[model samples]
Target: MLRELEKAEQKWGGSNKLIDQWLENRRKLLVHYCQIAGLPPYTNAEKSLPSFEHVKSFCDLLVDYVSEGHFEVYDQVINACEKFGAPCKAAIQQVLPKITPTTNAALDFNDKYAETQDDQVLYQLDKDLSELAHTMETRFELEDKLLEVLHSKYSEHAQQA
Candidate 1:
């Protein structure tokens, strides 16, 4: 899926409406998986250990899955911005470097910590990972909003032209 997304980004950029819908679906999946996994505030220590472990396992899979999804979406969005020439292209260009490293680092750390079965460790990791996921969710949402704004502006420009 990541490879396909890369190709799409390279070939058509993320300007395609189909890619935007896919990205939104991926975001929804990530949020749903997180909720079901009982990570963060949803996590209760007093809850059955077996169940929690299962949820943890689910969450681990989700983190891995959604991390890849996010990477693809981000790559496509960046490519789209570059190709579409948004009015705010300069702003997006400036942010690319700072955003990529931060997201990558957080994903890397979460992936490593996710392997531990220890309750204390898992709980701590869950707390951190949950926060990270929330941040990612917010970032994606904000990016979508930016895309909306850009699309509207581009549409107006097209009409003028």
Candidate 2:
């Protein structure tokens, strides 16, 4: 499967500047994630454990991404939806609640892991980070659904202010 982010880029990448920038930020997040997880171009032939610095750095990036979603993306999309009327409002009502858990989890993950050194308790931290990443992956899907709602119906009019 091509995955939500990649699929989203192809479908809505440049419909507007906000979507374009958001998707690009998402791409960078994923690549950094894969690097921390030792999963690809960041690696090559050998998988490596994430450094404590890498873990903290990724956590910071994750927090910034979440903040941007709430403070920037949500504000822009909801306002656009409002301007578009009922179906848009209905779609947001249906989707926003579902995204709350993901948002909370990302925040929780930051509080729980951001300052901790992964090497202090390597095994446990690795397991917990794995779970965190999985949650992040799922969260991205829910977010993409929210964005799709706006892009699918009102991209032409959703240009940022």
Question: Which residue pairs of candidate 1 clash?
Answer: none
Using TM-score as the measure, the top candidate is: 2
For candidate 2, the 10 contiguous residues with the lowest summed lDDT are 152-161
Mind giving the per-residue lDDT tens digits that candidate 2 earns over 46-77?
A: 54557778778888888888888888988888
Question: Candidate 2 clashing pairs?
Answer: none
C-alpha lDDT of all candidate models, in order = 0.54, 0.76
lDDT of 1 by residue, 1-161 (tens): 33333443454346667565555455444554445545454565665433445545554655554465457655655665665565556655655554555466555655655455666655555456566666655554445454554565566668988
Off by over 4 Å in 2: 44-48, 155-161
Error of 1 at 127 (Å): 2.1
The local lDDT score (0 to 100) that residue 4 gets in candidate 2 is: 74
